[model samples]
Target: MCSSSSSRTIPAALAIFLALLLHWSSAQLSPSFYDMTCPGLSDIVLDVVLQAQISDPRMPASLIRLHFHDCFVDGCDASVLLDNSDTIVSEKDAVPNAKSARGFDVIDAIKSAVEEACLGVVSCADILALAAEAALGRRDSTTANMSGANNLPGPVDTLAVLQSKFAAVGLDDTDLVTLSGKEP
Candidate 1:
């Protein structure tokens, strides 16, 4: 009887530990994360995005899609922005992203502007997150995952497939509907 009670207590303690770890990890992201480091970060990103929108009406949607793709695969690390390198194959070359993923130039412009404002202080991953007005304080990943990119849901994916893909990423039916509502 004592052994059974101890086993249950052990599992409960482990579960609590795991829950706190996940919370702590996610709590690293804060909206004002770059406020002190990059004072005008959002303004800079917004200026570039607005400029890009003038030239291409689809720029905003493209950026949102880019952010979504990056997050879905690997938690918004900006691996999608990587180009072919000696050690990296780049998610840009993935089937879902090859032809459809775009607005790289705009990202480049934002990076340039941010660099000019605060050289080597801001990260590309953070820039991508800010441009999309999503989360913040994410660090860039050193490596890209082409297979993960390849598995991302495509435009032609069925409702069931989309739901499955979103579920795989810990998103629910409401998330599916909300994200699906965004148009490109």
Candidate 2:
């Protein structure tokens, strides 16, 4: 029921193309992506995220989780950034995100800065991607997940369940182990 109603199935070829597009958008993103269009883009976004992290120590992890949730729901197209409207039911209101998702204000602040610098050139998707990357360097606390955290693996979950979760996203065992190794 949490799945987006707006999501539609496509032909195999179209699905492949969309997958490639998402991969290309992520793989091609670089710190220098805005060098020509907005020379200060990276600095601006980094500063804002840093400030946000200082104000709310959980901001970094929230930013990372927010990006992951956004990507999971809508292929990292920044659909999560959309506020609820008459015709739009925002992903932010999803059960996984109801109170867990954060850093929207930071994203908005960064978006404003990007707009002032490069205007229409920067996409919200790019902002989210950049902010998630910037958030990596910031410190985060090792906080416990609250009840009903449906989207993440449980601490005592078996290896099979963990592997299955990764497989659902097209990740192999290698990716699962590699990602698991990053956990504290």
Candidate 3:
């Protein structure tokens, strides 16, 4: 459940609009065009592309959607340890590992590796926070190289595609709506 190109790489204004839209929505409505503008396109898009490297061919958008929906629901909390953390929402009881979220989990690992290489030079948030900024930039580059397209997908489409795709997966309509996360 990945996003389409038309709605990828959303502007900042769109992201806020989309968030507000989510606030008012009822069922798993198509993320309103306004609320579809997600701010983390670069990272999300990159994730979809990378995931496509797998052979399953179940649509990258769907897989990505499931991950994002989960992350956003819990405010992208990296501490969502299945058996460890107490705050994880029990809806489907998400499993913690390299599969569902490569976000804060990998962000933490990268910070650790970078620290071992450079030592206490990076704050956890700085290392983890810029992940989206740095990732979106790279996503922009990848799209540029592919067909000289400016960006692969817009922010809204990125999220919507994920929703559509993941719905086909086990992630349900209810889980997405209830999503909460510590904002990055």
Candidate 4:
């Protein structure tokens, strides 16, 4: 009983759905990603985060914010950590990140320590994710500037605005609520 146009539409819809599903599947993150290569990675990160907190009590909060910002802008990649160069525009200079983001030095120190212990093993991206866990197990994006900063909602933003920002990064209402409760 199906018309020809309806039949063609169904196939096209299925193709698009499959394409999207594949893309999402490929983007998954796994805790076991570093199990074999760097068993001590989490401990290393937690130690560093704790040490940094000693000097700067804000370190933990800043790290949590930094990780969230990085994820929103670029799927949790450490692209946010890259400094500007002749061939690259750093995400740090981006509007949302400009003077707002901190804890890079802490991340650098952590990276150095991790590298010393397990060289060529862990990635800054994964470190960022794991760092969040260590801080929370203890605690706790991009370069588009206008678009990037705009993507991170401000403190005075309404619930709707906050929801929009979270949604922009593929997070849902529940995620937004969860994030809002993570502050000190």
Candidate 5:
């Protein structure tokens, strides 16, 4: 009799324990709750991160792949969000000091904002992908609006010509878009 009663009580106790643990750990939670559409906070942060890395060449290609995987596999569920787990972000390391740049600064600003709001909630992997996508989009849009190849980075402009302008903005053509999250 005692064994039977304890077995039934154990399940109930375990359920309550799990519920409380989930609640306590979720104190900070996130801006966008997980759902089918998009992970709101994660998406926004990733966008900012991709924008940040547009001009950075040192970033690894594998990191870029992970960004898309996170977004596409789960529609920005924030699961792809890897912590890169580094307490210290190396954003300041790769940039050159003398050059005049606009986009890198924007990227930095975005990173800062996310840190303020979500900090550990996001991962370096997601941030990198986000920054890349934003940079790519900006460059693409600029080219589309251009009149000709000879003009200021118009779509018709040669690939090399566009790169020069991208340097000014701290971005490149290849840095944009992830395979999955663009639509979601």
Candidate 6:
């Protein structure tokens, strides 16, 4: 049997461990990550996004959503961009993504421009992050997590359910509201 003090200490220790883990994971992201390998990466991404936004005002938001979905399923690995294949089921076909997610064409254009500028130097996952205006060092995932994509929070989910889902991803109420673009 554990005493009250020990029980409290256990939770505190667990919280600290989780915080450290999150920090360690995000510490790899840097604004200058592609400075050497892909000097023109950001400019290429920005140009494509700007052109896309001109044609579709919602392109910016859609790119951000695409980044969020990709990250949520498998740590921003660009798995959301995959299509149905013999070895992969694809997150795009998930209910939460189908008919809602967009900006793939923009991403493809960005890839083309980036490749022309600096071939094989950038990863699609990093490109998605850049399109969302986030600078991060990310790698592409060869496999997609269909089950994880299916479990993403939906439009009609209750507040409690949303909270639970966000919490599972180490996000809180503030993150939930901010990401949802809603006011508390």
Best by lDDT: 6
Instruction: Estimate the overall C-alpha local distance difference test score of candidate 4.
Output: 0.65
For residues 25-110, write the lDDT of model 4, one tens digit per residue: 34334566677778888889999988987887667667766766765665556777877776657778776788889999999999
Q: Candidate 6 lDDT, tens digit per residue, 53-87?
A: 77876677678778778877757789999889999
Q: What is the lDDT, from 0 to 100, of the residue 43 in candidate 3?
A: 43
The reply for model 1, stretches above 4 Å from the true place, is 1-25, 181-184
Per-model root-mean-square deviation over C-alphas? 14.4, 13.2, 15.8, 15.3, 21.7, 12.1
**Best-matching candidate per TM-score:** 6
List of clashing residue pairs for candidate 6: 71-76
Candidate 4: how large is its RMSD?
15.3
Off by over 4 Å in 5: 1-38, 42-102, 134-184
Residue 94 displacement in candidate 4 (angstroms):
2.2
- Report the Cα lDDT for candidate 5: 0.35
Q: What TM-score, computed on C-alpha atoms, does each candidate reach?
A: 0.79, 0.65, 0.28, 0.68, 0.24, 0.82
User: Candidate 3: deviation at residue 41, Å?
Assistant: 20
lDDT of 5 by residue, 37-130 (tens): 3345556655654554565432323333333233222222223332222442221121221121124344346557767767555444334435
| Model 1 Cα lDDT, one tens digit per residue, 24-122 | 247777768889988999999999998887787667667777877888787778899999999999999999999999989999999999999999998
User: Worst 10-residue stretch by lDDT in candidate 5?
Assistant: 137-146
lDDT, residue 146, model 4: 39
Local distance difference test, per candidate?
0.78, 0.61, 0.34, 0.65, 0.35, 0.79
lDDT value, candidate 1, whole model? 0.78
Comparing candidate 2 with candidate 3, which one achieves the higher lDDT? Answer: 2
Residue 145 deviation, candidate 3, in Å? 40
What range of 10 consecutive residues in model 1 has the weakest lDDT sum? 16-25
Candidate 4 regions with alpha-carbon error over 4 angstroms: 1-28, 134-146, 158-163, 180-184
Compared with the true structure, model 2 gives a TM-score of 0.65
Give me candidate 3's TM-score against the actual structure: 0.28
Q: List residue ranges in candidate 6 displaced over 4 A.
A: 1-25, 181-184
